[model samples]
Target: MAERGRDEESGKFTEEYPKEDFIKALKELESTGTTDIAESVGCDRRTAYLKLNILEEENKVESKKIGNVLLWELAVESV
Candidate 1:
C-alpha cells in the first residue's frame, strides 16, 4: 500500500510509492526512462526519478543518460 505523510520541508502531504513497484517495473521493462517507469509504477515522473536515484545510491540499479533522457535498469552483479 502507498503511504501518505507530511513533508518536513514543505509541510504538505506526500505519497510514497513502494520500492518493490519500481523493482518490478525495471524487471519487466528491462531498461526504460522515468516517464515509462512512472507509468509502470503508477506514480508521477518526479516520484519515479527520486526513487530511481535512491535505488542507484543503494547499488540496486544503474543508469545512463542518453541525450536528454536517463535510462535505468537493474544493477548487474559481478562475481
Candidate 2:
C-alpha cells in the first residue's frame, strides 16, 4: 500500500509507495528502462535508482549499460 500526502500550501498530492511494491514491479517488468522503474512504483527517478542499486547489491536485480541508457532486469535463479 502507498502512503498518501498532500501539501497544504500548494495542494499537491504525493504518494510514498513502498519499496516492496517496486520489488514486485521489477520482477514483473523483467527488463525495462530506468524511468519505467520509477513510473511502476510511483516513486521519483532517484529513489528508484537507489532502490535498484540496493537490489543489485542483494543479488536480486541486474543492470546493463546500453549506450547512454541503463537497462534493469530481475536476476534469474538457477534451477
Candidate 3:
C-alpha cells in the first residue's frame, strides 16, 4: 500500500512546496493543470489541489482557466 505522509519514491517531501520547486514547475509547464502539478510535485492530485488552495489563500499562487481546464502558477507579486 502507498504509505501515508511523504512519498520519498515520488519526491514528495513534507516540507511544503519551496519557492524554487514552485518556480521550476511553473517554468517547465508555463501554465499547468492540477494533475500536472501533482505529478510535478510528486504528490497525489487531491493533495496538490489542497496545497494549491492554501497557496492561493496565502496569495502565493494563482489560477487561470484555459477553456475548461484550470491552470496554476505561483503569484509573482507574492514572491
Candidate 4:
C-alpha cells in the first residue's frame, strides 16, 4: 500500500492542467467556435462545449452566434 501510494505521488496518477494553458485555450475558444476550440485545446468537441457551458454558467465566459458558428469569449465584467 505504501509503495502504491508512493507511485501515485510520483505523478503516475496525477494530472495537472496549467492555468496558462487554460487561459490560452479560453482565448482561442473566444476567437473561434467549439470545434476550433477543441482542436486548439487538444480535447474533444463535446468536452470543449461542456467546458464552455460550465464557464458560461459561472459567468466567467459568454457565447454569441456569428452567422452559423457560436463563438465564446471571456466576460470581463461578471454579473
Candidate 5:
C-alpha cells in the first residue's frame, strides 16, 4: 500500500486518486486552464497536468492556445 501522508496545505491524509476523476471533472467544464482543474480536483497542478496528458493521449481531450494559457476541453465528436 502507498504510504499516506498529511498534505501540507489541506492537512488531510493524501491518497492516490484515479486519473478518471480528473476526466470526470474536465467533462463538466466547457474549457478550463490547468490551475482551475487542479483546484477543482483538490490536487496539485502537476498532477492535473499528468492526468491531462493521459487524456490527451487517449484522444479524450483537446486544448487550444488562448493568449499565453492553454484552455482544455472534452474532444468533440462528429457523426
Candidate 6:
C-alpha cells in the first residue's frame, strides 16, 4: 500500500487519492454523497468532502442538499 501522508524525498504531503482520481470519480457518478465518492476513490470520507468543497470553490463541481444529504455532481461547464 502507498504511504498515507508525506513524501520522503519532497518532504511534502502526499494524497492518498489524487485530485484527478477524484474528478474521474465524480464524472462516473451522476450525483452522489461524499462517502460514495470516497469509496470510489479509495480515500476517507473526510478527504472526499474537503476535496469536493475545494472543487466547488473552483466551480468545477456543484452540490445540492437534499434533506440531510449533500449530493455532488460535476458542473455543466466543467464537462
Once fitted onto the true fold, the runs of candidate 4 whose alpha carbons sit more than 4 angstroms away are 1-22, 28-30
In model 4, the Cα lDDT at residue 79 comes to: 24
Clashes of 6: 0
* RMSD versus native structure for model 2: 7.0
Model 2 scores a TM of: 0.70
Query: Model 2: residues >4 Å from true position, as ranges?
Result: 1-17
Query: Native-vs-model 6 lDDT?
Result: 0.89
Higher-lDDT candidate of 4 and 5: 5
* Best of the candidates, TM-score: 6
**What Cα-based lDDT does every candidate model obtain?**
0.89, 0.79, 0.76, 0.67, 0.80, 0.89
Q: Write candidate 5's Cα lDDT for 1-79 as tens digits.
A: 5588888999998757666677777877668998898888888999888888888888888888889998888877500
Candidate 3: give the clashing pairs.
none
Residue-wise lDDT of candidate 6 within 1-79, one digit each (tens)? 6556888999889876677887899889879999999999987899899999999999999999999999999999989
| Local lDDT at 45 for model 5 | 91
In the order shown, the candidates' Cα RMSDs to the true structure are: 5.5, 7.0, 5.9, 6.3, 7.6, 2.4
Residue-level lDDT of model 1, residues 1-79, one tens digit each, is 6567998999988656878889999999988999999999989899999999999998998999999999999999610
The deviation in Å at residue 7 for candidate 1 is 17
Clashes of 3: 0
Q: Could you estimate the TM-score for every candidate? A: 0.77, 0.70, 0.64, 0.63, 0.71, 0.82
lDDT of 4 by residue, 1-79 (tens): 2233224456574322333444577765455688877777777788778777877787777889999898877778742
Q: Where does candidate 3 stray beyond 4 Å? A: 1-24
